[model samples]
Target chain A: MTTSKPTVFIVDDDASVLKAVARLLRSAGFKNALFSSAQQFLDEHDSNASGCLVLDVAMPKMNGLALQQTLAAQNSELPIIFLTGNGDIPMSVRAIKQGAVDFLTKPVNDSDLISAIQNAIETNQTTRQARSKLHELQQRLATLTPREREVLSHVVSGKKNKQIALELGTVEKTIKVHRAHLMAKLQVRSLAELVKMSERLGIISSPLE
Target chain B: MNWITIVWPMMAASILTLALLHLVVWFKQRQQVAHLFFAIAALGVAVMSGMELIVMRSVSIPQVVLLMRWLHLPLLVVWIAIICYVRYYFNAGRLWLAWTACYLRIFALILSFTTGQNLFFSEITHLKQVAIFGGETISIAQGVLNPWYIVGPLSMVALVVFVVDASITLWHQGSDTARRRAIIFGCIAFFLLASVGHGVLVHTGLIHSPYLVSISFMPTLFAMSYELSYDVLHSAKLAERLQISIIKREQAELDMQTQRNALTHLSRVTLLGELSGSLAHELNQPLAAILSNAQAAQRFLAQENINLDEVRDILQDIVDEDKRAADIIQRLRLILKKADCQLQLLNVNEVVQDVLKLVRSDLKNRGVTVNSNLSNNIPVVTGDNVLIQQVLLNLMMNACDAVADAVSIEQRQIHIHTRWNGTAVQVAISDQGTGIVSDDIERVFEPFFTTKPQGMGLGLAICRTIIHSHKGQLWAENNNECGASFYFTLPAYSGETI
Candidate 1:
């Protein structure tokens, strides 16, 4: 994951704006991939790749908002940064609520744009890291027996071996074996590490954490 | 009774001549009043001649004269009809309207009936022998005039007044020189002279015998006929001249308006030329999008796992965007198209919007905010669309420049409002910029006059010209305190009445 190079994708309906922004991004020390429309970007998009998207809010056919919904439906984690020429308040609020990384008004200052792009890239990296961890956790879970799977869920829920035994109607010694085997197979050395992994994978959100 | 030999031929000739004159008027003009007068006169003469012959054959002299006196009633009725006919021929029926002359004819008929008892007519000497040119002796006694005789003169005076009133009406209505003086007025003069001859000669003691007045009738009647035909021909010529003058007036007004609009448009075109880079930028987006979409479609088709449906949609989008780019280009080109100026009709909103597009970036650069409220259902107005757009662009550009000059970014606002006027559309483009002084307002639309250092001053003048070409009006007025509002109006698609 660390070996992959990062790029900022720009999508705009206006060519002059597209060219101007593309030039600005290049000047700001960013590798930029350009698309004129959301559809065009989607057609050539590699959802698995880690990158930040710069999408214009107003566009023909498929706008930036619709593209966001499409990406969400596909569960793609490429963080989006919205760019709008006519930036109204309602649209900004709506975009931010829809999980947009940032909304920047056009003819934006160079420092402001670079900062937004950096934040988006960092967010995308975090999302990809979390998704990959989930994949790894799922792979580990596939090795578990039905009984072990049940014991694993209870154990993660702050259940002691004795509580697990009482809940599952099993002996303490048997519960101990299941816990030891689950911990080893899950590759978790501590309960805190396991909870953190689960939280990051979106399996659960602990109030205490 | 030599009455048949003496009176019948002459009565027949008079009646036939009256009928022929009426036929000429009717056939030439297709006028209805002439037909009416002809029927009444011809019938009156025929009936009176028949009664005279019948009375002479069967009745004694005194009784015959008594009965013959009543024949004057029908003849009086015919004479009154001639006055009405002549009045109508000159288009005078509506002066008093209400068919007042016909009512007067009825009064004359009733008076004619009462005239026998009243001695509306009487023989001065019962047995006077008068010599005839053909070596024949005839009892040609002159008839005495009575109170009923006053009706004929009174009717003539009223008729002459009716004609004089028409002439005055035409004068007040401002007819042309020839119509006011020569034809229409002359017609009244001729009619008054003849009417007075028949009306007042005997009562005023100007003539002893009616034969003296009778001699004037044939010549005057023919003269009146010729004068009326002349009036018709003259009216036709006057109407033609009026129609031409109206067109010329309109054209002159249009030319003046066009001059103003063209000046304004020229200024706008110059301003737009300066913002050509921004315009290119606006157009380039769709062009680039079209290219990118085309490239994407080509790549998808070339690939083994080509999504045909997606590619087709992409191609459709490419085409659509391409057309969009082309349309923008076309609209921009319209401003630049070395077009020969033409005038026609247009939806004002469409023209306004197109012109706005031409200068939108300049407005943005100047930080001027423009708000437009154009009624959707405004009637199609007649004007030159290109020139109209040119006018709007000029005005808007001027507003933007004025805003820049004032250096008030927050108040650099323009409002365009339109609504349907009853017979016109009122359009106002107001700007909150530095106001033009009261003294300068009137001179703003003059050709080659500009207050701005860079301005050609032709802007407002050209706006005026274009507005005038559309048969509209344009002017500049100061806002409440700080700005100027350019107001204009266009005539709606209503029709003209005759």
Candidate 2:
């Protein structure tokens, strides 16, 4: 199978491992960076980034698994591929403890690295996409006026403008004005666009979505 | 000339000696004082009665003079004891029964206005004056068993009952109650003996006169008189002086104790002053968190009308945080409540946690690492929690301070352990810092000794006090290679085998 460049974050204290992993990823056409230690990885939490971690199982200051802990603490969804030079069952047990993407030994098989990276990159991309959609919806909702937002609830309920006006105890003209403003603020040109906005933003998921 | 003529004066002397003994006992309720006085009084009654039987003689003016002199207060002293001992022994702390006795005394005094003639009628009647055994001649001032005399002795009995009853209550309330049982039995025995002695003089006509028969008991009276007058009086005087010396000593001890207590409290206050920052920070965090959370909810509420469920959740959070704030305040107040450690059943784990919190920042500042491997399931033990905390804190702090001049940061490590040993909870607080020499462990609990340049040497001593208060054991020992460990054990009481 044809594989694209897979993004991985390599965290370790040994300068050679950090450099070698970064070079290996570069050689394999993988987008990667070298974080000297776990503390540095913690300081650089990027839920917006599309990547996974290639961590050293045991490092001087902070081991690979401990960095995984730091990532978990920040509530990031980036996948992790634990790569320890000196591997053991206990280290593997710890790596798999927190839903790691994959556990691999140092000088990992190029194919295994590529496949795991592809999987992690794909997962991270999906997370980013979902987050962007939610952000867009939140921004759109933020633009709507207090009154227009109230009317917009009724509009989503498939109520006609006149019916919405009657239900809200307001004039039909006022209902029309509110609906237009709501449509404009939500950046939806039509009713179909509005339903698609609700679906895409996960405001309301369709039963068959 | 017979035993009857000699009886009045000797009885009066016996009563006088007894009254004096009672006075000393009343002032100084020391065991030696009381035992000496009472034994003297009982012996006096026994001896004077015996002497009257043995020696029959005439009434000298001096004898009448002595009888007249001692007439006033000895009976009164008996009544006083009846009231005082009864009140004390019963722990009644009430004066009504005693007050009634007082009034009855007044009534008896009022009735004595008619002269003792109505009480004891004196007659020089002719009778057989036999020098041989078995024949009796007597002129006697016979007592009528008048209601007044009966009132006094009966009231005295009532007082004994009051004391016995009080002791019974004490027996029920106290744990080691054999002492109370002994007291009650002793009083009961004496009461029976006195009643019989009084009966023999009144009804049996043992010597053909009340006064003469009493004279027959003179030898026994003197033996008792010697015990009472000299032994009780002298020993009681000695006991009184000893008691006064004891009181002075106790007073001095109490004064010194109060001073030491004041100093300790002052030192603690100074210690708290040093801990003011940590205390303030500890107090302020929850308060600040409470304020921020409240404001966040308020902002959320103000931005738009909040949902009922969301509002309810916010309110619940506010209530929970308020309780947290209140708990911080309560804990702070409790810590500052002036070292009054009341004894109760406490979980050892709590003491460990509390000491850690109190000294956490201090240890951090000193770069000392404390690892607590507390047994969460340690059983609740009977002890003073704060005092145990104090003991733990002292050891930890001493460890921390001891390593101040040491080389490595790793050396300043403190480890705490809690364990259940079937019948007791054992807590071991160990520190890998400076270790005490083997010679010093035995004398460490002694007062006014120190290895440290600035220490008062009272901390470990006081720790022993607290441990003993809980019926627990505290000792220190060096670990296998290095460091020192302090282990204390608290007993699980009354079938608590955890």
Q: Kindly list the per-residue Cα lDDT of model 1 for residues A1-209, writing each as its tens digit.
A: 74587888998877655765665565455788889888888899666667799888766446688899998898877788887766578988998998998998755655677789999898888878766777888898777788988887787788888988998998999998987787788788988887776665555776776
- Give per-residue lDDT, candidate 1, residue B362: 54
Can you give the DockQ of every candidate in the order shown?
Answer: 0.03, 0.01
Candidate 2, residues B90-134, lDDT tens digits: the string is: 344246656665665555544444444222212212222334333
Off by over 4 Å in 1: A1-209, B1-10, B13-277, B299-313, B329-356, B361-392, B403-446, B464-498
* Highest DockQ model number: 1
Q: What is the Cα-based lDDT of residue B431 in candidate 1?
A: 81
Chain B TM, every candidate: 0.49, 0.48
In model 1, what is the error at residue B376, expressed in angstroms?
A: 12
Global lDDT of each candidate? 0.67, 0.60
What is the per-residue lDDT of model 2 for residues A92-204, given as tens digits with 9 covering 90 to 100? 88779887988876545555766788888888777767777778788988888888877877777688988988888989999998888888888779998887777766556
